[model samples]
Target: MEFWLRVTRSQITKEIRAGRTDTWAAFALVVRLFREAMRKRAAGDERLWGDLLRYAQDVVDRTPGA
Candidate 1:
C-alpha cells in the first residue's frame, strides 16, 4: 500500500510537471493510475473502480472544455 501510494504521488508529480492540470488531464491521470493498479491486481474491486471511473467521467462531461 505504501509503495502504491508512493508510485501514485510520483505519477502525479510527473503529470503536474508536464502541465497536466485541467479536468480532462485529471480524469486521464485517474484512469491511467486505475489501469496500472488493476493490471497489478491492486485496485480493489472491479465494481468500486467502475463506479469511481464513471463518477469521474460524469464530472468531466459536466465540466466545460474537459
Candidate 2:
C-alpha cells in the first residue's frame, strides 16, 4: 500500500513538474499497477483497498485537469 501510494505521488509530481496539462493518464497508470498487484497477491483486505482508492480519488479531485 505504501509502495503504491509513493508511486502515485511520484507519478503525479512528475507530471506536474513536466508542465503536463493532463494527469489522468498518470493516475490511470497507478490504478493499473495497483490492480496488477492485487491480482498477483491475495489482496483480501477490502478496507485497505478502499482507503487506497479513496486517497487516489481525493488526489485526483484536488488536482487540476485530472
Candidate 3:
C-alpha cells in the first residue's frame, strides 16, 4: 500500500508537470491513471478503490464529450 501510494504520487507529479500547459493532456493523463488504478484494484488491492473509482467517474461526468 505504501509503495503504491508513493508510485501514484510520483506519477501524478510527473503527469502534472508534463501537462502543465495543456488541459486536455492533463485529462488524458488522469484517465490513463484511473484505468491503471482500476486494473490494480481489480487485481487485488481494495483499499481506497471505491474513492478512486468515484473520482474517475466524476472526472468523466464533468469532462466535455467524454
Candidate 4:
C-alpha cells in the first residue's frame, strides 16, 4: 500500500508539473487506476480499497483549483 501510494503521488505530481491542469481528466485517471487495482486485488478487502480511495482523494484535494 505504501508503495502504491508513493507511485500514485509521483504520477500525479508529474502530470501537474507537465501542465496537465484538467481536474476532470486527472479524476478520471485516478478512478480508472482505482478500478484496475480493485480488480487486481479482488479479495473482498474493504480496508485496502478504502485506503486507496483516501489516497486518491488526498491527491485530488491537494491539486490546485481542484
The most accurate candidate by TM-score is 3
- Misplaced by over 4 Å in model 2 are 1-43
What does candidate 2's lDDT look like per residue over 1-66, in tens digits?
899688878978888889884787767876797786576456565665666778879999999885
Instruction: Sort every candidate by TM-score, greatest first.
Output: 3, 2, 4, 1
Q: Write the per-residue lDDT of candidate 1 for residues 1-61, one digit (tens) a residue.
A: 9996787778778777798867457767877977765765564556756766788789988
Local distance difference test, each candidate? 0.73, 0.75, 0.74, 0.77
Residue 16 Cα positional deviation in candidate 2, in Å, after optimal superposition:
14
Could you tell which candidate, 1 or 3, scores higher by TM-score? Answer: 3
TM-score of each: 0.36, 0.38, 0.40, 0.37
lDDT of candidate 4 over 1-66, digit per residue (tens): 899668777877888889886844877886797787787579766776778878868999899774
Candidate achieving higher lDDT, 1 or 3? 3
Off by over 4 Å in 4: 1-36, 40-42
Reference-based lDDT, residue 62, model 4: 94
TM-score for candidate 2, residues paired by index: 0.38
lDDT of 2: 0.75
- Tell how far residue 34 is off in model 1, in angstroms: 11
